[model samples]
Target: MKVKFYATFREMVGRKEVEVHGVKTVGELIDYLAEHYSPDIKRELLETPRVGPNKPIDGMILVNGHNVLHLKGLDTELKEEDEVHIFPPAGGG
Candidate 1:
């Protein structure tokens, strides 16, 4: 799978995209990124803890142009051909 980083995430990882393997779910991919990239990546992706049964995410994670929050949050499944995009939180007025 090709994981693409946007905004600050690109700077944190020092690249725009990377080839990730051995991860089947969005959560697993985040763990892999934190290990291979920086711990900040994890911090930016996941926020606080699960509220009830919903996983609260800090930023936006999209799988094939679909928001994971709308799917299954971090538990969203991934495929070898899937394109993952990660974006940090944005604040504008």
Candidate 2:
């Protein structure tokens, strides 16, 4: 899968894009990257609004040009060729 990070996230991973393999869900994907980056990923993308300690994040997560909110949230399944774009919170829009 092709994962792209926006805003400061690009700096977080030190690259705008990365390729991840063997992740079946968005949650799995996030966990993979967060391990390499920071736990703040869980805080910023998954832990915001405090839905629950283990609840999925409702941040702006897009898979293949469609929002995961309309799909299955973080449980949304992924394919080998899917494009995952993560857009962090923005200011001055």
Candidate 3:
């Protein structure tokens, strides 16, 4: 599977995209990234929003353009042909 990183996430991982193997779910993917790259990647990808529902992470994880929140969250299944997009928490003035 191909995972794409955006914004500060790309900087955190030091790459725009990567090809991962053997991860079957979003959670597994995050674990794989943390194991291979920075351990901080897990916290960045799975932070809980301070003032929202106490679930879904603060950032976004998408599979084939569909937000994982709308699919199965961390349990969302992944396929080799699927494209995963990871975006850091949005911020603006």
Candidate 4:
């Protein structure tokens, strides 16, 4: 699975795309990424300070142009060739 970070997330992660191995659900991917990155990213990605591995985020996570929320939220299963996009809330007027 290919995970793509955007905007501030990309800046924080320092990479646009990351290829993960043996990841089944979006929740697992999030846990893996948070463990790899700095504390800042871990906090930003997690819903609460003491939340579990599958905590949901207020932001949006897209799987192949489709919102993960519509599929199965954090439990959304990913397959090879699938593109997962994480985006922060957009604010404009």
Best-fitting candidate, scored by lDDT: 1
lDDT of 1 by residue, 6-93 (tens): 9999999999999998899999999999999988998876754433255578778999999999999888999999999999877788
For candidate 2, lDDT tens digit of each residue in 17-61? Answer: 999999999989889999977666666887667445444564578
Q: Per-residue lDDT for 1-93 in model 4, tens only?
A: 888888888887899988888888888888888878545555665665534545466567899999886888878998888988988656578
Q: How does residue 12 of candidate 2 score in lDDT?
A: 78
- Summing lDDT over every window of 10 consecutive residues in candidate 4, give the lowest-scoring window: 47-56
What root-mean-square deviation over C-alphas does model 4 reach?
Answer: 3.6
Model 2, CA-based lDDT:
0.82
Which pairs of residues have clashing backbones in candidate 3?
A: none
- TM-score of every model? 0.89, 0.84, 0.89, 0.79
Selected candidate, larger TM-score, 2 vs 4 = 2
| Candidate numbers, best lDDT first, in rank order | 1, 3, 2, 4
lDDT of 3 by residue, 49-92 (tens): 44255556778888999998899888999999999999987888
State the C-alpha lDDT per candidate.
0.89, 0.82, 0.86, 0.78
Question: Which residue pairs show collisions in model 1?
Answer: none
